[model samples]
Target chain A: MKKGKAHVLKIFDNVNTDYIISGRYKFKIANMKDLAKYIFEDIEPGFYKKISKGDYIVAGENFGCGSSREQAPWAIKEAGISAVIAKSFARIFFRNAFNIGLCVVSCDTSSIKNGDVIKLDLKDELVINISRGERIKTMPIPQLMRKFLDDGGVIGHFKKYGDFKI
Target chain B: MGKTIAEKILSSHAGTELKAGDIAICKVDFCFGQDGTSSLIIDSFKKSGRKKVFSPSKFCMVIDHSAPSPNVGVSEIHKKMRDFARSEKVGLYDIGEGVCHVVIPERGHVRPGSLILGADSHTCTYGALNALSTGVGSTDLAMTLISGKNWFRVPESVKITVNGILRKGVYSKDVALRIIGDLGANGCTYNSVEFYGPVIRRLSVEARLTISNMAVEMGAKFGVMEADAKVAAYLNENAKINKGIEGVTADKDAKYVKIKGYDISSLEPLVAKPHAVDNVAPAMDLSSIRIDEAFIGTCTNGRLEDLKIVSEILKNRKIHKRVRCIIAPASKRIFSEAVKRGYIKTFIDAGCVVVSPGCGPCVGTHEGILANGEVAISSANRNFKGRMGNPDSFIYLASPATVCASALEGKISDPRNHIRV
Candidate 1:
C-alpha cells in the first residue's frame, strides 16, 4: 500500500499492447531498460521522457489489450509507474503485470483527473483523491496474484519458494 | 453439476473436479513460445536460476514471426532463439515453417482434452480441437518452462450455439467476425467460450481453426468446439491421438454462465472496420471505400481452402493496378500444397506477392507493410490502428473471398456477386 501522484496518460478503451510498445521494438531489443525508451513512443512521442517515478496511470477499460508482448508491462514498470488503475484489463495483460510485480488496480477511473496526486492503499484496496477530496474503492487483487507481487515477480517468487507455490 | 467442456478438461488436467474461479496449479501437456516472446522467456528462464527444463519434449520455440529476418536486428533475435533451443534440447520450428498456431495443430501436436499454453495470445487457436489452450505472458511461460505447471483460475463458460445452414459466399470468417461484433471485444473477457451446433460441427477442421483463432479477439480464454468426425479424421490422418475422442464433448447437462445463439442461414459477409475488431458492418455497406492493398493470407484464412478460393477469384483477372495483393500461406505444408495445386502460380500470375509461410505484415514485422494513408482489406484477425505497420494506414478485416474481390476492384467489395457456386 502506498500513496502517489497520478500522472494519467488519459488513453481510451482497449489500449492495446501495440500502442504501448510497437511490434518494431519487440524482438529488436533485449534489455527492458533500452526497450522502455520506446514505450508508448508511437501513441505519445517521448512518453517515457515525461512520466516520473512512482506516478500512477489512470485509464479506461480493457487497458493492455492485444498481443502477449511481455514488454508492454515491462516497459510500464521500467517507466517507473508505481500503479495502473483501469476499469478492466485484458486477462493476459493482467497476468503479465502481476508476474512482473507491477501494481494494476481495477476501478472506475472516470473521476480521476490527470496529476490528481491520488493515494493508494493496495492492502486496503482503496484509492484516495487527496486534491479532489474523493475516496474510491478498488477491486481486491486475487489472493494468488498478491502472493506473486509480494515476492517481487514470478522469478523472485520461485527463488523464495524453490517452486511457484501459492 | 455437469461440467462444461472447459470445466471437464480442466478438471481432468487438475486431477480434481473444479468449478469456475477456483485457483489451482495444473500440469501442462505442452507449451510453446514464438520468436516475438521467446526472447523474453529465455531471459526470464535464465534469471529464474534454473538449468534443466521441466520437460524438453513438451516445450518448443517457434520462429514464424518476422521470419527470414526482416532486418539484421530481427535476424540476431532469431539466432538467439535458435541457440537457446539447442542448449535446452527443446523443439525448434524455424522460419518458413509456418505460424505457430497453424503448424502446431497441423503437425498433430495438439490433442482433444489437453492443456496447451503459448506465449502468444492466439494460443487459443488449439481450442478448435476441444483442447483447453490459452495465452500467457513470457514471464509466466518461462515459469511454465521451468516447472511444467502453472496456476489458473478456472473461467466460467459461455455457450455459443450456431445453427442453420450457411449461404454460399458466406464463410466461417463471417461467422467469427459476427460473433465478435455481437459480443464486443471484451464481452467474453476471462471466460471460456464453448461453441456447439450442427453448423459448427459441419464446418471443416480448417474452418474450426479459423473460428477458434479469433477467440482472443472476443476476450475469451478459449473458443472451443467438441471434437467431431471431421476433427477425429484430421487427427488420425495427421497427428497421433493416443486417447479416444469420445470423452471430449461437453455433457448434455453442462452448466453455462450464459448462452447465445446465432443462425447462419441468412448470414452475409461481414467486415470489421478500422481501429477495432468489434466495429463490424455488412461488407456491402462499405463497397464504396477503396483499398490500397488486399492481404489474402493470415493464420485466420491462409489454409488450403482459402488459397483455392483466392486463386479461383483471381485466375483470369488481374488485380486493379492500384491494389497490392499480398498472399502468404499460414504454414509450409499449406504453402507446398497450394503450390502443388497450382494456386500459388495463379496468385503470382494475377500480380499477387506470395511470401513464405509466416506472420509477416500482420504484426508489422516484415513483408507487405502498409504506408501511411493507405487502406488495406486483410484476412487477419486484428485490424487495430497500425497493426499492419503505419498507424496512419487503415485495415479492414474480411474473408479471403472478400479480400480477393476487393483486390480486383480496388475497393471494399462484397464477394456474393463474384464467387460462382
Candidate 2:
C-alpha cells in the first residue's frame, strides 16, 4: 500500500519517447539525473525547472507511444515524478515503467485539471482530487504487477525472490 | 478450445496447458540485448546484485545499433558493451557482423518452437519461424538474464488470412504495408497475429520474415506464420537442420479473437507517408513527391532477394543525380551472397553507396542521415519524427522495388511502370 500527493503536469495523447527525451541526448547523457533535465525537452521547454520532486503527470491516451527505449521511463523516474496517470499507455512504455518502479495508472483523466493537487492511493486504486473534492476510480493494477511495484521494481523483485521459478 | 500458435508455444514453454490471459513463467531459449539498450540492462542487473548470468550460452550481446560509432559518446557505449560481454563470457556480435535480428536467424539461432526475446521491439521478428518471441524493456531483459525465465500473459490471436499470389513489382513489403494501412498503428495492440492462407504458406521464409518483422507497427505482440515445406527447404539450404526445428501447428478448431482477410492478386505497391507508419498512401497516389534520399536496407527488407530485385531494376540505369541512394544488406552472410551473385557490383555500378551490413541509417546512428527539410524513402519499418536523424526531416516507407524506382526518378513512382513484370 502506498499513497503520494503531488501537483499534476498535464500533457496530451501520443506523447512519444522522442518527445520525452530525444534520441540525440540518449548517448550524450550518462547519468540518470542528468538525463532528467532533458525530459519533455521538445514538448515543454524548461520542464525540469518547472517540475519538482513528487510531482505527478496527467496525460491523455497512448502516452509513451514510440520506441522501446527504457530511457523514457528512466528519465521520468529520475525527474522525481511520483506517478503518471493517463487514460492508457503504449505497451512497451507501460512495461518499462513497472520495471523501473515508476507508478502508472489508467483512469478517466477528464476530471483531473492541470496544477490540481492529487493524491494517488495505489492499494485502493483511487486518484483523489483533493483540490476539487473528487475521487476517480483507477484500473486496478494486476496482481503480478502489484507485486512488482511493491517490491520496488523487477530488479528488486528478483533480489527478493532469488529466482522467478513458480 | 484448441490453442492457437501463440498459445501452443506458450503452453509448451510453461510446462502446462494454457489459454489466452493465463499467466505463465517460462524458460527463455534465446535472449539478447542490442547496443542501444544493453548498457541499461547491464546497469540494472548489476544494481540487482546478480554477479553472473543464468546461462551464458543462452545470452547474446549484439552491437548493431550504433556500431562503428558516429561520435565519442557512442564509441564509449560500444566499449562498455564489449567489456560487459567479455566479463560475462556471452556471445558478442561486433560491428560489420549485421543487424541483430538478421544475424540471429542467419546464424541459426531462431529455430522453430523456441521462445526468444530481445530488448529491441523488432525482436518479434523471430515469430516468422513459428517461435513465440516478443520485445521487453531493459529491466525486463535484466530479469530474464538472471532468472532464465520471464512471465507472459498468453495473448489472444488475431488470424489474418491472405488469398491469391502477388504480382511482380509487389513484394512482401507491399503486403505488410497494406495490412498496416488497414489495421492502423494500434489495431492489433497486445494481440498475436497469425498469418494463414495459401499465399502465406507459399511465401519463402525470407519473405515471411518481412511480413512478421513489421507486426510491431500495428502493435502486434507476435506475428507468426506456420513453418511449412518452404521453411524446411530454406533451413535445409542453410544447413540449420536440428531436432528442435520441428514446426508447431495450431489446431483446426482454434479460436481467434478477430479474423481478417486480404487479397493480393492485384495489390499495388504501397508506401507509408511522413510522420506515421499507418499513414499509408498508395505509390501511385504519391508519385509526385520527390525524395532527397533513398535507403534500401534494414532488418525488414535487406535480404538477398531484396538486393536481387534492386539489382534487377537498376541494372541498365542509374539513380537520379538529385537523389543519394544507399544500399545495405541485412547481414554479412547476405552481403557475401549478394557479392557472389553480382548484386553488390550492380548496386555500386548504378551509383548507390553500398555500405557494410549493419543497421545503417535505420536509427540515424550512422550513415545516410537526412538534413533538415529533407525527405527520404526507405525500406525500414517506422517513419516517426526524428526516426532517421533530423526531426524536421521526412521519411517515407516503401518496398525495396518502389524505393529503387523512386531513386531512379527522384520521386515516389510505381515499380510496375519501371519493371515490365
Best DockQ goes to which candidate? 1
Q: Scored by CA lDDT, what does every candidate get? A: 0.88, 0.86
**Highest TM-score: which candidate?**
1
Residue-by-residue lDDT tens digits, candidate 1, B198-236: 888888988889999999998899998888778888888
TM-score of each: 0.98, 0.95
lDDT of 2 by residue, A121-140 (tens): 87688998878899999999
> How many times do residue backbones clash in model 1?
0
lDDT of 2 by residue, B349-382 (tens): 8899998888889887679889989999999998
lDDT of 1 at B74: 81
Predictions' DockQ, in order: 0.79, 0.57
At residue B414, candidate 2 shows an lDDT of 94
Evaluate fnat for each of the predicted models and list the values in order.
Answer: 0.72, 0.51
